[model samples]
Target: MSIIPSIFGGRRSSIFDPFSLDIWDPFREFPIPSSSDLSNETSALVNARVDWKETPEAHIFKADLPGIKKEELKVEVEDGNVLQIFGERNVEKEDKNDKWHRVERSSGRFTRRFRLPENAKMEEVKAAMENGVLTITVPKTEAKKTDVKSVEIKSLESYIQVLIDVLTAETRQNRVTPLVSVYEESCYRKISSEFL
Candidate 1:
């Protein structure tokens, strides 16, 4: 049982196998899931894939629900903003003589919820299922625009002239004032930034 096939194919690898040119994955016991598993989380508790889009008129959602009937699906809106979509597709039980070679086509129940924006018109929300796809559209209202007033940009030349005049004035003795150090640091930063 210790011997197993390497990821590189027919090559056999064991615990004592050298690490060069051969990679031994520690999590090999768990097999990588198939594409069906990603789209539908299998029979136990299926979680289907859903797509959402927004347009000028409404917010639309498309859920992939292959081989599902209208009677098997449920769509609801809760608390005004949460849109819920849930459903299940169960296969009929067969006799002992009948065997299922592959069971990836069936899936169990799964619930998915989406938080709608304030502009969503939940009361008028509509859903339709066609061609293995469930599409839901939530009409939207015009959002209120906030009042934004632009401020005028004052001329910086006067400020720069004042700053230059203050910096060029003679200091009291040889003492390095805090303002002088600040100006020096800012000048150094500006010079360094220009080079970069």
Candidate 2:
């Protein structure tokens, strides 16, 4: 006979839900929490947020981790590319007489992974924690220079002409004209300055 009572099981929902806002409370005059606030709280409960920066020599990462001890944190590189930061925070035990109204602080294991760039030096990575913040440094490898040596050259025809002049001078001095074969001339024609 009553659809609303049957659907809701005769129990009113809190103002956190839009459908439950039908029954307003005069005592509850506080503003409703926004979606952004909920998201921020959720992120805070999960992995700590990090800031990444690239410098001339290295890549740096800074993560905010409040109320976490240095012994609980672990930083490592996996598969030569992934940088992993993992840690855990335990909830403090309450006394027998104390009552908790709300528990918003997160207490669990959290992990954050980042893909390192090609130039990052995985072997030389360093990490430090200070003032509730963890900082990681990944140095970059020095660039390699080409080892190829350059050679100078003139035109192919000019090179052949100089050879001919040398041969002519030798022939004149020796009174013997060394035979210049047609094959040699053909080979010289096919040769280019780039080869030299």
Best by TM-score: 2
Give the alpha carbon lDDT tens digit for every residue of 1-196 in model 2: 2225346345455656556444665533434445665566657847588999999899999999998888989999999989999988887998999866545566777899999989999999999999999999999988778799887687767878777666667676875445653444456666743366
Top of the candidates by lDDT: 2
lDDT of 1 at 141: 92
TM-score of model 1 vs. true structure: 0.52
Candidate 1 stretches with Cα past 4 Å from truth are: 1-45, 96-99, 145-196
Q: lDDT per residue, candidate 1, 1-196, as tens digits?
A: 4245557656554456553335555554335556656465564346678899999999999988878887898999999999998897876778999855545455577789999999999999999999989999999998789999997664554445555556555334435566785785587567556654
Q: How well does each candidate superpose onto the true structure, as a TM-score? A: 0.52, 0.60
Stretches of candidate 2 above 4 Å error?
1-40, 159-196
Please report how far candidate 2 places residue 87 from its true position, in Å.
1.8
Model 2: which ten-residue window has the lowest total lDDT? 1-10
Per-model clash counts, in order, read 0, 0
